[model samples]
Target: MNTKQLIEEAVSLPLEERAIVVDSLLRSLNQPESEIDKQWANEAKRRLSELRSGHIEAIPGNDVFSKVWDRFEK
Candidate 1:
């Protein structure tokens, strides 16, 4: 129904479901043609092209996360 009712219903949802609702709501607030989206799209395409052309190597997710944790974790 209205915003208040919608918010109350969303809050009553389970934690994971509430998080999905919040994420979707936040996404809706952004314009698809915004500069940020265009930049991300271009970056994604560039990464995909690089992977296909072998211009750069793709690191495993675990390796990437391990590097991040090694740098940031105490």
Candidate 2:
């Protein structure tokens, strides 16, 4: 089917199905690189290990956001 016809059919789908279709289309246009994803996963694991081991202290989200807002207001 043509683009217009395809769009009409997609629009007729149920909300959940439409979301799946949209996500599929977006993923197709922006494919993730497995190597970069793996690197990010490793970094996340390292950070979590550090936090658990007390090698680094976790900052409270409220304090972080307050500092950010304070900087912006200056």
Q: In TM-score terms, which candidate is top? A: 2
Residue 57 displacement (Å), model 1: 0.8
Give the per-residue lDDT of model 1 (tens digit) for 1-74: 99999989999999999999988888899747788788999999999999999999989999999999999987
Pairs in clash, predicted candidate 1 = none
Worst 10 residues of 1 by lDDT: 27-36
Local distance difference test scores for all models: 0.92, 1.00
C-alpha TM-score for every candidate: 0.54, 0.62
lDDT of 1: 0.92
How many collisions per candidate?
0, 0
**Tens digits of per-residue lDDT for model 2, 4-29:** 99999999999999999999999999
Q: Flag regions of model 2 displaced more than 4 Å.
A: 1-29
True-structure RMSD, every candidate: 4.3, 3.3
Any residue pairs clashing in model 2, and if so which?
none
